[model samples]
Target: MANIVAGIGWHVIGAGMAASFYAPIEKVKKWSWETTWAIAGLFSWILLPIGVSLCLLPSFTGFYASIDPHLLLTIALFGAMWGVGNVSYGLTMRHLGMSLGIGIAIGVTLVVGTLVPPIMDGKASMLFTTRGGLYTMAGVFVALIGVAIVSWAGHKKELQLKGHLEEFNVGLGLLLAVMCGIFSSGMSFALHAALPIQEAAKSVGVNPLYAMLPSYVFIMGGGAVINLAYCFIRLAAVPRLSLREDLRQPGPTLRTNAALAATGGIMWYLQFFFYAWGEANIPASMSYVNWMLHMSIYVLCGGIVGLALGEWAGIRSGLLRLLWVGIIIIIIAANLVGVGMAYSQ
Candidate 1:
């Protein structure tokens, strides 16, 4: 019971961290997406992760060395692919608005993040052969229903906002968001494949909670590399990126840039922090549920915050109610996933 409580708490903390991540980006002024992403990458993908791993994981070096080079490379490559998704997610949010953007992204993540790892591990049968597996599969279907509802509401909202909201571009945003979900969830498969690193950490007497850091470092490092490349490419294409003039005219641009970078860095790392801790509390058989729970909470919190921030303002009351209904469906889906995991254990 205590462990379950801890798992729930950590999951909530993880969700909060994810929710707060993009808030900082809204603060960044004058800088293009390229500059902003580069700064965020430094904090999120590089400095912060290193600092945490060094501080928490005592056997970091030994464990890192013990992993197979080929496996590590594969994980890193997946991270790089996920990085592209991450960049696209930001753009999706900008174009789609929070409710629709997150709904679509989570839909993709739910499918990929939950199923891919199990399939890769050759446990695809577990999802159907066992009663618990059946429940989980059911939960996934229910969750998809919720996502559909949320997305439908978002679609309606977007239609209503067409004339009022100048920045609306629902079509492109939804497309990119779906792509983001698929690739972002790919990270879970990467982590699963790097199980050797986790074993190495166990052999070295490191706390299981901290042992996961090294794997994250490698994975996030890959993501960082890809995002850095993309940023550089954007920089090259846009000569204004070289302009010192924007820097000179900025108000809170620099400050916002620094803050966003720090926030994004910390936010990115917190997912694993909670994941590692949550893994400690749950049975290994249920690890896939962790991703579902984490992503659901993230989407829920982001949606709620978006509402609070007036992002959904001026929409009809009927539309707002519909959105809430969608949120409820997502909640049901998350609960089903959790229940299925518990039953499996």
Candidate 2:
């Protein structure tokens, strides 16, 4: 019962964190994407994870030090790939709007993130051979269908708003979204590759949850490198991307940037933080479900926010109803994944 409570708490934390991540970006006024992303990156990809890992895990340094260089390199590369996806996501959201962007991104994330690790581990059959596995796969299919419905609703909304297709680029948005899914899913493989560091933490009598922190430090370093470079290039080209200039801007920009940076950082870290803690609650056999469940809740919360903000303002009431239906399907799909995990255990 305690474990179940822990799992539930972690899931809630994960969902809230994921949902709130983009809230900060909305606060940056007049700052270029380069400046805003860089500021947020300072906390999200760099400081927060390192600070938390250091504070919570005494053995973090030693555990990280003990990892094989080759394995470390591989994980770092995977993190870089995930960074590309992260960078692309902003562009996707800009081009596609949050409802459709998230729908497409999370949909691809669900399929690739759920399937790739199992396939890599040579346990692809686990997704089909067992009843639980089959159910989970079915959930994936259902979730994809939900995504399609949501995307279709977005298309309808766009047509209603603009009266034509030229205003929105569905093809480009989807392509970027698919890429985000593939690369974002790579983080799971990166985590698996860093198992040695995790074992080292266990060997030192630390909580396994604490052990995962150091690996995150290394993995996030890769993401940081990519984003940092992108920021620098933008700053260079624009010449006014200076933090000094950004701070000099009138009313709430600096304060908002700092607040957003802190919030986004904490929000970003919370995903892995809860993921690590949640993994401790569930059986190893059911661990993969954690990612699926996390992503599903994120989609649900994002969808709610999208509606609340009237992103679908001009769409017909019928399409709005279809949007809600899609959200329901996503929730059902998430529950199915949970059921599959329960049965697998």
Off by over 4 Å in 1: 57-63, 118-130, 239-246, 249-252, 283-289, 342-345
Clashes of each: 1, 0
lDDT of 1 by residue, 89-161 (tens): 8787777666666766776676666577678779999999988778778877876777677777777877877
Best by TM-score: 1
Q: Which stretches of candidate 2 lie over 4 Å from their true place?
A: 59-63, 122-130, 163-169, 238-248, 338-345
**Candidate 2 lDDT, 1-345, residue by residue in tens:** 688678767877887677667766755677776777777788878897788767766665665677688888999998998888887776676567666677778777777776776788798899989998998899889988887887788777776777444436666788888888888865777788888877876776768756677778878889889888988887777766675677687666667777876677677778788878877786677675576568777887777766665667767889989988887787777777777767877
Q: List pairs with backbone clashes in candidate 1.
A: 44-265
Superposed Cα deviation of residue 121, candidate 2 (Å): 3.8
